[model samples]
Target: MVATAESVAAAPGWFTEAIAELPEHREVESAGGAIHLRCWGRTGTPGVVLVHGGSAHSGWWDHIAPLLATTHRVVALDLSGHGDSVVRSEYPIEGWADEVMAAAAAGGIAGRPYIVGHSMGGRVAAVVGARHRESVAGLIIIDSPFQEPSGESIVRQLRRTPKAHPTRNDICARFRTVPEQSVLLPYVARHVAEESVRDTGEGWVWKFDPDMLRKRLEQGRIPPLGSLRGVAAPVLYIRCERGLVTPERAREIAALFERPATVVELSAAGHHPMMDQPLPLVATLRTALAQWESR
Candidate 1:
């Protein structure tokens, strides 16, 4: 079920409170037929857009977006097929990139903007930067596996695993079991769980289309490494030491960039470094931004 404003407002006490804390914004329309985005940040400030990984929405950045908004006009979006965005039964990774570009354009981010993405979003960001180099100021990838996604890979196979939920109550119960399944902020986890379901006659049910996983698996592949060579802006890759994206593999991928790319290994973090260690992640981002501005 599509998320209604009333439903969002009537969500659990903690989630409702969390939603209240977010800043107000004008909704920017996109041609992709998705919900117009609610944006934050000051006008004319250097733009920075955050893209989330698969099965997640813009809420994933609930913890980090506010922090980044202080410096740059940060914009985190719910890519099509996730969150409040329109549900497309068949969506491809490239289509996700196109939606981001369209959203950025509608938000008046005309020139190169700092683009940061996680997991699948990281891959989309790379494709955007490579294909639209003139519009990308810098690229920041967080814990995204740069290796090819194959049918045999653990993640790919897991996507194919059929999850059984007989009722809405069952779905909610399953969610409760993994309340802290992610390393993102607690509020983010709450938002994800809250937005993930719809109150049906029987109980709560998943809002996202299950086919999304299969589409992702079928279309998700390692983008051509050579494509990154077209990106003129410097790149910074923040990788979690024990995350899905290994340090050695990150270095190897970074080497493929035509320009030298900086890689920072977060020793005590996992896939969601921003949530696992916010301060360090923020500091690293600040340093990278400063370095890029200096150059």
Candidate 2:
């Protein structure tokens, strides 16, 4: 479904207000394709670029971004094939880094900015830091696995899943199963589900090209943990006590970093620390930023 101003206006109360409050920009060209970027805080200010995980849009950072903006410029984008961003026929994890770089350039974000990412986004941030070492000031990875995936293994996983176009209802139903996801349902049903439409008479369909995820799974291999060792910037890894990234694994990943990355485990949170527990996440972020600046 193609997103337009009128459609966005028709979005639900929460979504409309959220989008309205954010500084939205468009037509930022990246190697993969053009993307729609939504930012907050003053341009040229010290900033943090937030990247969300797979199947999630930049809006997932809604709560955290505003709080971060109060102290530092905070930017988030609807990565290609997700949210309001243009869906491309093909893309990869490295390509996402390029898109981020383009958006940063367009926003006139000179010098390096703190790069914060979650899940798949964490992988992208690592790749970007490795490739454009000077452009990233520091890294904050939330619940990301440091290990790379074998290409063969990824391809096999894709082959097992059937490909099909998803409907708005289909997407909503899937999100309904997760407890954390429940909080986002109202907004999704209004903005995302409503915005994602092709008008087939029967009903509206999802705008995202299903092939993007399939292609990513097949071609995307996480960079080796050693690749991150070369990043000179300090690293902060935050994991939920009950999330996928166990304390043991977090420690193991931290040990791989030559610069001695700090690891923080939020006991009250899950995979989505900010959403599950915003206050603690914000406090942790503030402390981390202060510590990074002091050093």
Best by TM-score: 1
Q: Which ten-residue region of model 1 has the weakest summed lDDT?
A: 176-185
* Model 2 agreement with the true structure over 155-270: per-residue lDDT tens digits: 76556543333565554344321224323234333443344344455655444555664655432653343366677778898987766788889988777666877998877676
Candidate 1: where is the Cα deviation over 4 Å?
Answer: 1-20, 25-31, 108-110, 152-173, 176-188, 200-202, 217-226
Pairs clashing in candidate 2?
1-207
TM-score of each: 0.78, 0.76
lDDT of 1 by residue, 19-116 (tens): 55584343444444664354556656777788988767676666566666666677777777776677776676667777777767655553668888
Regions more than 4 Å wrong, model 2: 1-20, 147-202, 217-226
| Model 1 residue pairs with clashes | 168-204
RMSD (Cα, Å) for all candidates, in order, is 5.8, 5.7
